[model samples]
Target: MSWTHTFTNLCDWYTHLLHNSPTGTIHIHILRNTITSNPDNVEHILKTRFDNYPKGKPFSTILDDRLGKGIFNVDGDYWKFQRKMASLELGSVVIRSYAFETVMDEIQTRLIPVMASKAHGENGTEIKTVLDLQDILRRFSFDINCKLSFGLDPGCLLPSLPVSNLADAFDLTSKLSAERAMNVSPMIWKMKRFFNVGSEKKLREAVNVVSNSANEIIKQRREMGFATRKDLLSRFMGLINNDDIYLRDIVISFLLAGRDTIAAGLTGFFSLLSKNPRVEEMIRKELNQVLGPDQESPTFDQLRQMHYLNATVHESLRLFPPVQFDSKHAEEDDVLPDGTIVKKGSRVTYHPYAMGRMKKIWGPDCLEFNPERWLKDGLFVQQDPFKYPVFQAGPRVCLGKDLALMNMKSVVAALVPRFDIRVVEPHHEPQFVPGLTTTFRGGLPVKVIEKKMLST
Candidate 1:
């Protein structure tokens, strides 16, 4: 279902379909898809029989031009090698500290100041600043991801709010590449690519812009000697054997992981906060207990103790997962845990966006934004990875999971007490853009007011 037809209610439509199904799984023979929102089916496909499901050639080919041999676009050894390298680097204390310090600095110096400048009223008036929070968060995340991946700042979040060619190109490429998959037939987009025309041409140009920029960064990292650097590109360079193209792919993969997902998550989190003032109050109370009002700057350790803040982020993700539905092609004919028989070479999709709304999995109040569901005795509790596959599960789980969470929490911790963000239209459901990430259309327009001014 296209956005034009369903008004971007595809996820909800799928949820309705799954709810009506006896086993919570449906096979569309025309699409050769086995779409499921069932936890048991998800667990079987994602973890129990992991090898039976892979990215497969069909899925990988769609992203190959932009992602190259990057982890997300591959299976087997390519995926395994990148995963191992990323795991080791991410698991390191140095990298974790590096990420925390980078996030803290960026939030304090760039993100806060930008929002503060926007929040100031003209001539001391009480008028609030109107901002596209989604756009701002994406810019904020792009800057941070550049630093994390290449140890460079593109100044995407500067007061001037300059447009970044690299970021823009990457976004276009992701959107168009995903467009290829949404076509009714693979031949349609593939033929367009063969003829080099229309949207495919635009996709090619955008990918070239992104690929060229990534290569330049890789070259600079090489000339500068990556042995001493702690950034992701450097660490990857040290691990991979002097293949600059491969290095570019690695860095680009990290860029994709770093930029959009966190921005989407935070955008949804604040939008929900605007609707649920009580949740906002509870978060502030938890923050007050953890970090005194006078203590403005939060340390990494202080952020860790913010269990409610963590829960709020989780709740937001459950409602608006960045990558709504993920698909894995079955390597062979297999019977799912739900007793649905998946044919060989069929796409097995687990719908996280739909699953989040399923009453069967989350009880009667599943549709509501309730952070307390994730809390037991005021401490955040983990859900089964299959049930909450937001960051994925098993061997291919997101390597940057912790870093993403820390940055998201850091942003909220820094700004929530200082400013208030209210969505211009809280009652309206967001129309999602057709892309690899769940980006809302119209960029989430909101009025931001300084908390001190609000208090007055």
Candidate 2:
């Protein structure tokens, strides 16, 4: 594959190589990277032989500065310890309820009102308005994450929607960290860091800003005596004491996990919904049946019962996964399940974006945005994790999977039934921004008009 072309069209380039390859895999000699879209290979790397492929030094080096020793960027006992603690906190019913309540509060109090103000004129007269839905969702997710992760509200979704220094710094940190992976040579970024110049200088400033903010939150929580709070940071503090840096890492990781992924998923989902009115209608119908014409926030059980909405969310994830591809380095020489050799230090990646588009994996209509593929007999059907590793697979599967789905479903349940979102550039394909998460290059521009009727 041409490096120039791959750089230009990352997902498409990977899809072309994987589909055209006889082995469903391709190796880029220049980068010593192996890319695979095969489910068997994905299973082998993620589950069957998981230990051999750790995040390794190369992958960790890119994110280590920003993530520290957080669960996402670490491996071995470090990862296991953090994972166990996180699992306990994330699995608790009380925490789930807290998170759900936070999301609902944001949506009801902030999200809806802001969008309504935009849809209606500033003074409340009827007006057609265009807004960047991507920006709106990002603000929504950031506010929710701040509350759930740090037990603080950044007020990002307020009417003024003030620009947040912490949020901006976090965004720059993520972009620069991702850029470290994309550089043809690590030396480029390494030298920049050593000299404290250019993007590297900006990266350092951003990381410091984020770290200081996290430290302040942790300090304040401690000063408050780590009161019985429901947020993740509070729960973590209850477990471990007086380790500020470690606590900061945990909070930052959760912020990234909870904020960007869900925001990106919602942005992609709404963008797809604007083009596919039938899917939007189906979601509205399900919401109506589940929550009635009043369109109240869904209870846990009610959220689960909206299978069509769930399927639509799954379909959106299938197409535009927040993390398009993930790389793991081999600990030693090994063989993939499909007879591909993996040398020590090789970067082996399973391309979720490409796998989602592969006809062999998803059938002839793979490229189409059809939610029916995920539904059978009016119920949502679970797919093999290896084939749909959006939240990943095996022992390292995302612990926040349940929380993320609930958040997405709740937002859809509350919003879709009340608004008609029309994409301003329906025919224009938005380019993907290369970052830690998948974001649109410019933004998803749309016109959101409040529905006249309360019923679907």
Candidate 3:
């Protein structure tokens, strides 16, 4: 297949191959890449016989300039050490509660107020205002993640909605890094890098901006003397002495994970809800019953009891996962569970985006946006990690899974009850932008109206 075709509609192209191939795997020679939507193959690469599949040098080289030896970009001892530290910190009750508190504060103080201002007309007359919800949510998540991960607030969610240099640079770095994975040959990008021209130049500048900002934050925190803060950076600082470079890489990884993933998930969820009013209504009913008619933010326990709302979020993730695909390189020649021989130095990617649409995996109604698939006896049903690897599976499973879900649910609970959101172009299908994470090509534009009862 041509790189142009693969680039044009990545998810569709992967799905097409999965449907046609008997083993649910396809090989592309551009990078000697193997893409699979097979759950057994996914389990093999991610869990069973996992040692053979590492992020490898190619994957590391692409992201090393930006990510460094951060947990997401490294393998072996480096990844294991950071993973152990983060797992313990992220799993703590105190950290979870602190994260929830931060999310609620952001929602109540910034997100809701911004939406309310947009929903209410300047003269106090009832009028729906057109807003790009994707941008708003991105700003909202950026502030929350900065506060939670670095103990610093970028103030991207303020009334002015100021532009954030760190956020923009991070976005550019991530996009360019992902673009490297699609190159027909590494020589092209290597030549550009060697010449210090074009996108590579922009990437270098962006990485410098991001790195400098993170280093400044670290220096400031160090000067303040690592207080008993619950933020991830503070916790890591307590463990790893004074390595600011390592700290910067870790902070960037957490920031990317926390901000982009939540924003993408919420964007896809709201977009889907606009097309499916019944699901939105069901979510509102669940919220109304659990939190009462008052627009109070949900407590951790209250958020836990929101089964239907949880199911809807899961349904959204199933349909539009934040990270569409992940790649690993083989350490040596080995065979996948489904008898596909893996060659040493070959890149293998498992497609969560295509897996969600597979009839074999999700059954006959796979294409339907039905939240009921995730509910049984009015409680959210857990699918196997290999089958639903949106947060990924095995040892590298996301440490922030619970925190991400809580942040997402809190935003949904806080916003959905107070306002009605309608997609401005209801009939238009969003064009997916292929990058480190999946996001709409432009942005999700919507019209928001304050609910009369909630406003009163």
The better-scoring model by lDDT among 1 and 2 is 2
Segments of candidate 2 deviating more than 4 angstroms:
1-8, 120-128, 453-456
Better candidate number, 1 or 3, judged by TM-score: 1
Q: Candidate 2 or 3, higher TM-score? A: 2
Error of 3 at 269 (Å): 0.5
Candidate 3 residues 1-456, lDDT tens each?
473444566687788788788988888776688999999999999999778888999999999999997999999999999999998999999789889889989998999999987885324464546899999999999999998889998999899989889889988998998888778888889899999899999999999999998888888888897668889888899888857898889878998899999999999999988889899899988888887866577789989999999999998999999999999999999888788888999999999989999999999999889999989999988888898999999978898999999999989998887778888898886778758888898799998877753434
Put down candidate 2 lDDT per residue, 1-456, tens digits, no spaces: 454544566787788889998878999898999999999999999999999999999888898889998989899998999999999989999899999889888989999888877774223455556799999999999999999999989998999989999889999999989988889999999999999999899999999999999998888888887567899999999877868898889789999999999999999899888999999888877777877766477888899888888899999999999999999999999988788999999999999999999999999999899999989999999999999999999999999999999999888887887788888889886788779898998898888777753334
**RMSD after CA superposition, every candidate:** 2.1, 2.5, 2.2
Evaluate model 3: give its TM-score. Answer: 0.95
The clash count for each model shown is 0, 0, 0
Arranged by TM-score with the best first, the candidates are: 1, 2, 3
Cα error, residue 134 of model 3, in Å, equals: 0.9
Q: Write the per-residue lDDT of candidate 1 for residues 204-276, one digit (tens) a residue.
A: 9999998888788888877878888888988888777658898888789888988989998999889889999
lDDT of each: 0.88, 0.89, 0.88
Best by lDDT: 2
Looking at candidate 1, the ten consecutive residues that score lowest on lDDT are 120-129
